[model samples]
Target: MAEIQTTTLIDDLTGKPLDAEKAHRIHFSVEGKTYRLDVDEKGADEFHAALDRFIEVSTKVAAGGASKRAAAAPRRASAGSGEQTKMREWAKANGYEVAERGRIPAAIQEAYAAAN
Candidate 1:
């Protein structure tokens, strides 16, 4: 007898799995609500491409403070989809137990920023 195991990641928008690559997780905010999505490389690129123009023109905001724009819970990854992936990868490499999905911890985010 033989035993085998497999795990497949599906794209949130397309509900399809990539043949050779795992999906990337995307975190974004709109109107004050935040969301997380898992997508393949092409989908990740498309999401960022659609937002690049707006991102280039938008002012950067600090993550925490009494400032009006500060989120109720401190948030990270105003950075584009690629950068967000980098941050998550960095966190895992540096001994942080980041999940394959969901929010990365604030400490991990701060360390990533400081190191970069």
Candidate 2:
């Protein structure tokens, strides 16, 4: 049987650290099981569309938001323009998954590496 894991992806939708008062729980299923996770509620409804888009694109790119942003910075500094576009394209072509903060989820990383 396949193992089941739950992960929470955090975003500063309001440009600030998340507070418990404004959080939404989103559930996703893996291997026929369901997992519930929380998201910032401040922009839960308003940013849902963009968040969804970001997740979809990130899944395909296999890069985390922070890593992508970090990776793009140097390029932008050197080129002085359009670093985001370049990074996105580079990630897509490389089959990377974008994570919310560039840091790999411990569970996911462990599972992938069989470290646990």
Which candidate has the top score in lDDT?
Answer: 1
lDDT tens digits, residues 10-109, model 1? Answer: 7788988855455688887776567897988888899999999999998776653223654488644376777779998998888888877666677887
* Stretches of candidate 2 exceeding 4 Å from the true structure: 1-16, 46-116
Clashing pairs in 1: none
Question: For residues 15-113, what per-residue lDDT tens digits would candidate 2 score against the true structure?
Answer: 444555566766644434666755676455765674677667654433233344333443212322354344444444556564434443344443433
Q: What residue runs in model 1 are displaced by over 4 Å at the alpha carbon?
A: 1-7, 18-21, 64-116
What are the TM-scores, per candidate, against the unseen true structure? 0.46, 0.23
Question: What would you estimate as the lDDT of candidate 2?
Answer: 0.49
RMSD of each: 24.7, 25.6
